[model samples]
Target chain A: MIRMSNISWRFLSVWRRNLIVYRKIWKVNFLVPLLEPAFYILAFGLGFQGLVQGLSYGGKALAYTQFMAPALIAISIMYNSFFETTYASFVRMYYQKTFDGMMTTPLSLEEIILAEIVWGATKATAAAAVMTLVLGLFGFVNFPQGLLIVPLAFLGGLAFGAVGMFFTGITPSIDMFNLPIFLFITPMFLFSGTFFPVSGLPEWAQTAALIFPLYHLVELSRACCLGLVETNPLLSLGYLIVFTLCFLVLGLTTMRRRLIK
Target chain B: MDQQPTAAGEIILQVDNLGKHYNGVSAVAGISFAVRAGECFGLLGPNGAGKTSAIRMIYGFAPPSSGSLRVFSLDVADDWRRIRSRVGVCQQDNTLDPDLSVLQNLLIFAGYFQIPADQARERAEELLHFFALEKKREAKVGELSGGLARRLTLARALINDPELIILDEPTTGLDPQSRHLLWEKLHALRARGKTFILTTHYMEEAAQLCDRLVIMDHGRILIEGAPTGLIEAHVGSSIIEVSGADQELVDFLAERKVEFDRMADRLVIYNKGNAEIEQAVRAGFHSRQCTFRSATLEDVFLRLTGRELRE
Candidate 1:
């Protein structure tokens, strides 16, 4: 019997515990979302801009780097939330046994997973904001409208965190995580309008990209960051919200089934 | 005997025909027990005998498939959150956060119960010293030795000032000294009216610490009573175990009408007194050690569960 109402304020305790632990290892974790992706931004920004210095390939865009940077920020948020909820949550659940420790102290399994998602989203939210700030410093961002992308990135993070938790909940072994990372996350990173516009891909590839949650996240983040949303941004935001809520329910149930027994 | 707690207004915990199954296979099959307000109760069993399952149910981690389990008179299914704040469970696995310092583990665990920061700090200091890990307070959990980690875990369970402490195989892998120290700490806590519910296969531990315990096997309780009462009722006052014996010893026992169980290569003869074993050992039959001693809980455990390897 998994109920959404089974969650309560105790989720905050788990969230706070992670915060305390994160404080101790902030040098490692904080840098991954902050500095680790800068190399990607620089390498791709400098390397690819030379080819499309004066032209746009997706039929409508200012410059290629300007077109790709917002997607990169969104993708960065997704990866941070994904890895946070997957390997990091796995370590807490299995290796460090912090999950078991928390369970004995009146925290239910549902509350714990909820907290993991919240914490993962928190980390990704920070990464999204920081990267947006970095993009602003580099003059790649478009002022007040660009600032709006930070919150959309946060919403995308919440959705990806839930997705990460779902995979982590069903994983039978540690090595099985590589399957999701390689199969799901890599494809999203490569094709979700991040490195290049999905419009450039084949018709079937674009259709496949629509099914990936990252694609909606990128659409929302890229539009908000560039002030170039053609349609109602709420459509993409609504998709992320629905996706997050669906997985929130599914993640809690799956993790509770796996953990409490 | 006067120090023994009598049945009071209500017991601390109760289980009635409790059962649990994993995918239709029973783990705890229709067993029941009670823990009083101020006494140490034990569940004694071999590995996979369902002691941990029972403990998990009481703590509300593993829900019962059938029957009722209650703690502090509150039903486990309904009032678990209310009951949980008053209870603490020290699980078999070392659930310590390895990335945190020894003191940090207690502090963070205390926060789970919403203990105030100052009070949690004070209790953390007190438990750190009580468990004799005060010196290692700043050391990370990964850096501590096995004994220290176990001690810290026990210390972490105390952070909430819980009334009922449930320990699962508390001394399973501890050295003799560590085991004794843990037993002493438990005794000291018991004296202060902190009720304990413990699970272990160590018969000696049950005899030493538990006021009353149940011996379980194959997912069911075989017997339950006070340590001495169970031994007296099950294994009797004395016993003799003779190995390397011939059929002559069997015939000799038969002539005296001595009831004994013949294992693969030995004879275990039970008695109402030590005289039977003493006289037999003095008679000098060709054998291994002829043991003569007043029975303890181990005798009762072995008699009920048998000496064969459960594995």
Candidate 2:
């Protein structure tokens, strides 16, 4: 039932609408993703650097700023994609009636869903670009190897965005959103190896982190940032790809039922 | 001029026994009507009736559950995408983008149809002028009064010079002045040969605007005709209402074998072109309050469906 051609250029029209509105409210912390990561780096980098000369994660000697910067990069993508697709899309779908308004036109539900995913991914990528520049200025980046993280972060965003949209479609009310955020997203943020090494966690906790999408994103993105190849890099990428496709299909299928009728 | 439509004209939309059901509950059941070119057609029904459902099918908001619906002589099931491009819909709620300014909303909507930039601007400007909204062009959508916001919504609907416009309760909550202003705008559009299919429960709205309309109730068309024709057919030229002292009046009419509907306090006698009903009411209920007036769609709905249309 889903066809990419159904989306086509019409997806851009919805994306353009979002950009136009975003441009108006850019002053209200539009740079939150960029600034948050730098602040985290400054705090963690300075705080940990003073206490200890260095850090070692997964048995690799590295500067404290070096290890944390990559994790923070993945964190930026996670926060941006989750917030944009969940809270922002919820307001647009239910509160603002933007989705209902679009359905009156020739725009199909598929195009609208695709556009929303693209918009979330684009915002996350924009944040990644800013973080990449900061990392380069501070000489924390592995140069061109860090470039690979850009596309990976965007794909990571596609998965997170799709997951957010599925909840947005089925939530009975605005308050019901808190269940997923508190139970699901908060756990992912705390345990996805974004702050510390997931390997350091207890056996049960580490196995649970592996099931979270952000954990795969953090592992893939940090490896890309440091130019270290995991034992089987394809496993990580393949995990993210499978999750992305599964959530994409499920989220869009549910949202189409919610929107079209 | 004849108040009734002289000719049905070229049918632009046709429905045959169209039905819609949601979760095993019927919203529209076995209803059919045709909208012709250059006519303001209306579906008149109460809140829980099938007015919105019927129009929803016409504009591709909901697919019909049974039977066939065609617009511009194209089947809705196969050609809704094409049907949507040519059909303009002004929804019941204000669906205007509050983030954008008045002119920007119209121009952005024009982009959906891939209307060329220059042409989109021209059409938007012309619509602004037509709606008398040029002065508010720079203001955000939320800044406008409700009337102006509704007018902007209608103006946005016209951005593509749509062949058929479908409006769902366009004036449901506006003030009298605003309603009159909107009615005037629709009237002006009608003068330009644009076809319209609207839904409203306001009897006066149907009588004033619709060239042909159906009085729908409980998911079915109870009666449909030109407003005056339905009024004349189901009711008559006039009806007499006697309120208070209603028991004697009711018994007198009943004993005389005159048909009338009785409420708690009033007895309404329908005329059948004989002075008997009228003269009897005048002779028997002279001491009570009696009033006479021409018939309206309200009378037709009550007569045919046995319930007030507004309820």
Candidate 3:
């Protein structure tokens, strides 16, 4: 029932529509990512650096701020993409009737859904780009290697955005979104090596972290930022790709069921 | 896409046994109708009478559970994109993007049809003027009043220069002034030979605009014809009403075999252009708070669909 052929270049129009809207409020949008890294660096650098000791990741001795900077990028990618597709896309689809309007055009449901996911990714990448520059200025991120995080943010964004859209499709109401954020997103945020190393957790907890899509993103961001790898770069990248593809299909299937019915 | 020119009287849309079911309950049950190339065809019904359901299928918003829908001589299931590219739809809901300005809404919508930039801007400006929304072009959609927003929605629908426009309850919540203005705009568009399929609960709106209309109830067409023709066929030319009627009036109507609705406190008698009937009823019931007037499309609608409230 999910027809891939229904998707075409027409989806870009929907993307362009979101971009037009995004550009209008981009200052408020950029403010969060730009200042968020500074907030975390000051908090961790002043508060946690002296208290935390022997912080070694990928065989490299790292300060608390240095260790947490790349992870902040990972979390931003997750938040930007996940929140956009979940809350923003839900508002457009349900409240604003944006998707309903688009469905009337030559744009297919698949194309609209694809455009939403891609737009979510685009926002995530934009935020990540801003955060990378901020973190690089503080000497927390490596020079050329840190630039790779921008594109990596897009991949991570797609993974999170597709899953977020999947939740948007199935969740009954806007308030019900708390269930996914609490049960899925919150746990991943805490456990997926954002502030602490997964290797330090219990053996089973480390294995479980491997299953979270954010874990793969965190690993990739680290590889790109610190040029150090605990997990193989290809393996982490491949995991995110497969996760994105699987959820992309699920997102389309679920959204088609919800919208086209 | 074919480039052949279509004649005015050609059938632009055809539906055969179209049905839609949501979770085992039927919304539209095997209704069939067609729209010619240059007529204002209408679907008139009560709430949940499958008007929106039927309209959704024609514009490819929802797939029919059964049967076929052909738009512009192309099958909807196989060529919906091609059909949709040439068709415009103004949905019942307020689907306008509140984030964008009124003019940006139209320009962005044009991009959906792959309309070029300069041409889209030109057409967008023309539509803004056509809908009388030129002054509010740069205003946020949320700031516009209901009428202004509705006008913008209609303007956005025309951005593609669509051959067929489907308006679902276009004037549902509009005030009389706005409704009249919209009707005038629609009349102008009809004069231009553009085809339209409209769904509405306002009988006057349907009566004034529809060249032909179908009265639907319980997911089925009860009757279909021109407004005056249906009114004449089903209801009559005139009605005599007597409130606080005595049993004498009821017996008199029964004895005369005059078709009438005998309510608890009122007697409504249908007169099919028989002046004698009107005169007789008026003379008999003139002292009983009686009044006589011409029957309208409302009479036909209420007579067919009944006066019961539908949720």
The CAPRI quality class of candidate 2 comes to medium
- Candidate 2, B121-214: lDDT as tens digits: 9999999999999999999988899899899989988887887999999998899999999999999999888899999868899899999999
Clash number for each model:
0, 0, 0
Clashing pairs in 2: none
TM-score of each: 0.95, 0.94, 0.98
lDDT of 3 at A105: 91
Superposed Cα deviation of residue A5, candidate 1 (Å): 3.5
Listed for each candidate, the true contacts retained, as a fraction, are 0.81, 0.57, 0.94
- RMSD (Cα, Å) of model 1: 3.2
lDDT of 1 by residue, A84-121 (tens): 99999998898878888887887778888989998988
Answer with 2 or 3, whichever has the higher DockQ. Answer: 3
| Per-residue lDDT of model 3, residues B1-311, tens digit only | 24454579999999998999999999999999989999999999999999999999999889999988899889888899888888889999999988899999999999999999999999998998899998999999999998998999999999988889999999989999999999999999999888999999899899999999999987888898999999889878888888998888888878878888877798778977788877887676788888778888998998888877887
What are the per-residue Cα lDDT tens digits for candidate 2 across A7-90? Answer: 668778888888888888676645776577678878887776777554567578877787778778787787788788888998
Give the top-scoring candidate (lDDT): 3
TM-score for candidate 3, please give it: 0.98
> Once superposed on the true structure, which residue ranges of model 2 sit more than 4 Å away at CA?
A1-5, A50-54, A229-231, B1-8, B308-311
Q: Please report the candidate that would top TM-score against the real structure.
A: 3
Q: Which stretch of 10 consecutive residues in model 1 chain A shows the poorest summed lDDT?
A: A53-62
